[model samples]
Target chain A: MLTKRIIPCLDIKDGRTVKGVNFVNIRDAGDPVELGSAYAQQGADELVFLDISATNEERKTFASLVRDIAKHINIPFTVGGGISAVADVAPLLEAGADKVSVNSAAVRNPGLIDELSKAFGAQCIVLAIDARRVDDQWTVHTHGGKKATEKKLFEWAKEGQDRGAGEILFTSMDHDGTKSGFAIDPLARLNAILSIPVIASGGAGNKEHFIGAFKEGKADAALAASIFHFGEVKIPELKSFLKQQAIHIR
Target chain B: MKLAIIKYNAGNIQSVSFALERLGVDFHITDNAEEIKTADKVIFPGVGEASTTMKYLRDRKLDLVIRDLKQPVLGICLGMQLMCTFSEENATECLGIFDESVKLFKPTAQDQKVPHMGWNQLRLKDSWLDPSLEGEFIYFVHSYYVPVNPNTAASTDYIVPFSAAMKRDNFHAVQFHPEKSAEAGERVLKSFLK
Candidate 1:
């Protein structure tokens, strides 16, 4: 059986690991390579490295960092942010990153998803959707939750699947870092719509939050930043707790 | 050494070559039988309907060359489907290197997803076929699957049971995308290359 994945996301800025309070007040955690290795040792199933800054220099940093981490870790890592073109993917994958996640760039040229999926194969491409609840519907957000896309969350997720996106990492911006636990209702809606494995992000305050995500939200994986980054929840302890809760863990 | 990716009306050849170039492996994307026959390894990859693909391969005599290769060969996506006896896609007859048929994945009790798309786990069957492939999740995206048989080296669950990876002697194929499969995928590729 494919074990339910436990992923810890690292918001990288200028080639270093950083965690913020509600996507603001960013602070450096440590070197990305070291931090990634630690996560792997702690039995993290996968890692997602988001550049978090939209700039040429930051992208280069992320690309280089992905390569650096890939060389050291024998697990999958996805690099997001400022990835604008097919050309952008080459350097990062070369640097040892297994997959590349596209956000604003993909929304702009939905065809870019096909192009990248075709160029790199479907599994190499990841579509990261930042969603926010708007008027009783979860609407897609772009530019790292800065802009609202007209595309509904599920509609676009199905589109991403059709376009050959390997996985859907859906993050709830309203619940991110809130520790209110995942917005189970919106995530459940997405889980019903997306045939792909959904990585639930945001609003994880406790171990039960993860169990709720896998059970209530039907998420393939649960991702947290502040909880793991701040040492509030140790990964091993959490995994044991989930295992006791009968949620499959590695 | 030159490596040839047998292009039987499939997806990107340049992308595979790009990955090879990064790994410093010399390769080419070719449909020419002579070029494929002479390469160190042959990779057969596909991204479209299998019936149309088999028709093209049969027309070009590529099917014979694929069956006859002695060196390491890799098949991805539909290419993996073609390596089996037949595919459910368009009721197509495929290269019967593996004695299994690709069947459609219908909506089942728990699995309502039509096209099983995403990164899923591979319960690698421990066998001499490929020990390195055991227990890793390879990325997958397919609506149909080759029912688990004696030849299956790995399996996954979607709408129903599906072969995540298959190994038949020198002719190895994976339903999941190894090039896209992250670390577990990297390990699978390393095992295949070994």
Candidate 2:
């Protein structure tokens, strides 16, 4: 059976693992390859490496990182951020990434989703949507949660499906870095709207929050950074707690 | 000697190659019939839907070539599934080289989830042991299970139970990735290489 995944996201800056709060105030996490191998050994189902740097040709660096990580670790890893062209994904995939995530650039040209799916298979494309609730409506945000786009959350999620997104990583801007808990309401809406697997990110403070995300939010996976990176919540302990909660994690 | 990794449109060929490289083995990844047949050993690694993978194999005449090979062949994950009779994931008609069906793991109300993704214990059957595949845990990530049969070399449990490894003549497979299984995985790969 599909165990609920415990993903430790590694933010990359200039090809190294870096961590930050609320997506800013960056600090070094460690070497991504070492951190990635440690997570795999500790039973992390997958790793997410987000390149926080803004380079015009940064995708190659991400691909090489994926290759290097694949060389050292033997688990599925997803690479996200700054992926623009359809062909840009091939390098990352060739480099050993199981999945590639696209953000603002994917929305800029939604057709790129279909092209990628057609070439690399749908299971390889993940759409990472950063959203915030405004006026009782979920509004999509772009450029690392700094720019609010006119696209409605549920609407774009639906469009992502039609455009060939295999999975949806929905992060709430309001709850991110807040440590309050997952924004279950919008996640609830996104879960109800999207048929593909939905991974909930942002604002996981404790084990119970993950339990709530699974039970109430209907999220297939809950991803957190600070809790896992800061040694506040360990992966094995989290899995054991989730198992006790009857949430099905190995 | 160079080993050949059958490379179609499957997703996991690179991982297998990397694993071999780690072991200091020279291997070639190719779909060319001549290249694969000429190698010392052949590996079929895949990580996508079964039917689509089988289609590409059949369309490219790989199905025929794979069945005729005399060298030791190892199939990993979806590659293992493609050797079976059929797969429920896509109602896939596979190579049927091995008489088995890939069954879906429909989670019980109390069971975990789909895509069984993690490490699990392995209980080896008496005959499957090549002296190297002893009791060990291997990483697995799939939604289907290969049913137990005469070729059942090892068994593993998830929500219920399923075949973790299978062996039939020159062809052998493990549902879990030996390449990704760390030291234990490295041991099994070494056994296969020998």
Q: Pick the candidate with the highest lDDT.
A: 2
Model 2 lDDT tens row, A59-90: 45666788998898876678887888877788
Clashes of 1: 1
lDDT of 2: 0.80
- Pairs with steric clashes in candidate 1: A67-A95
What is the per-residue lDDT of model 1 for residues B1-194, given as tens digits with 9 covering 90 to 100?
56788865565343444445445556677888788888887788766668877988999888898988888888887888999888878899898888888898777533255456545666768642356555555656677788888887778876567777777777788887665554455565556555
Model 2 RMSD to the real structure? 4.3
lDDT over C-alpha atoms for residue A147 of model 2: 93
What are the TM values for chain B, all candidates?
0.89, 0.94
Winning candidate number (DockQ): 2
- What fraction of the genuine interface contacts, i.e. the true contacts, does candidate 1 reproduce? 0.19
lDDT of each: 0.75, 0.80
For candidate 2, what is the TM-score? 0.83
Off by over 4 Å in 2: A20-30, A57-59, B24-26, B30-35, B38-40, B48-60, B86-93, B101-164, B175-194
